[model samples]
Target: MEGKTCCVTGHRDLPQKEINHVKAALRREIDSAVADGFTRFMSGFADGVDQYFAEIVLEKKKTNPALELIAVIPYQKRLDSLMAKGRTYEMLEACADVVVMQEKCHPSVYSHRNRYMVEHSDRVIAVYDGREKGGTVRAIRFAHQFRKELREIPVGLILDKNRTNLGQNRI
Candidate 1:
């Protein structure tokens, strides 16, 4: 679990339709990784795609005893704010075997969190829409800088193919 580490990064908002597609892709990638003896998965546990990835990894961890989910928490206060919204955060937190809580919660907390994940991981499972200059892009870039193997679930692939939402809506 320590050596075979992968991280998840993605936008905070995404359409439900696109989410389902990403979920399927994620399941395939994660399960394949498991078969290859890659057991550790780190997630920021942010809203939308991050949470989805965490949940899926947790589910896999249930039957696969070797699988471990590590929550790279940026700040406890921000996590508390998200937890106040509902039980999803609690569920994710419960599943994580290791919670890496960062000490500082500054304006650049998320960027710092992304750096931590990228630096710690051997690979990255990125879910990006490719429509914005967002945190997801920055994290992917950082992973690239470290030469981590990236497996992307590009939401823009689906959105752009349909060309329905244009750029008005983003995930």
Candidate 2:
């Protein structure tokens, strides 16, 4: 359709509660996207939030057949790190259109994957802790540089700095 396509990115390691928060935010984003006539989703298939996004899209596809879920994998060997590659394979086989960046694995493949996602998407939904480095930060930077609309769920913003419990108490 002539609507937006969104890509999902997030931290690789997160606490369970934060993961749930990210999922909740994603659900809201998906709902908003659907309302805005966006029916396509792209995910990089990373361990944490990416996988969650894909799974949610797959679930939504059951009722909304018009939705398209595309898995943009960094490399083929990324499957090795997956706890259950078969599940991912089956999901991709059943719901997603797979795009592999490189036939062989490389340390830099994830960057390629992030670029591909950003290039193909009109918007980015990021669950970021606002780290200065890492793939999520890099992807956000790319989105910013490309002038793509960014929907960021800042999970770590509050915990980033420890201040006084009361108003303006300094040691």
In candidate 2, how many Å is residue 67 off? Answer: 0.4
- In TM-score terms, candidate 2 sits at 0.86
Q: What tens digits encode model 2's per-residue C-alpha lDDT throughout 23-83?
A: 8889988888788888889998888889889889888889998888988888767754542
| TM-score of model 1 vs. true structure | 0.83
Give Cα distance to truth, residue 161, candidate 1, Å: 4.8
> How much is the lDDT of residue 131 in candidate 2?
81
lDDT for position 2 in model 1: 61
For model 1, the superposed segments whose C-alpha errors exceed 4 Å read 82-86, 89-93, 96-101, 157-171
> TM-score per candidate, in order?
0.83, 0.86
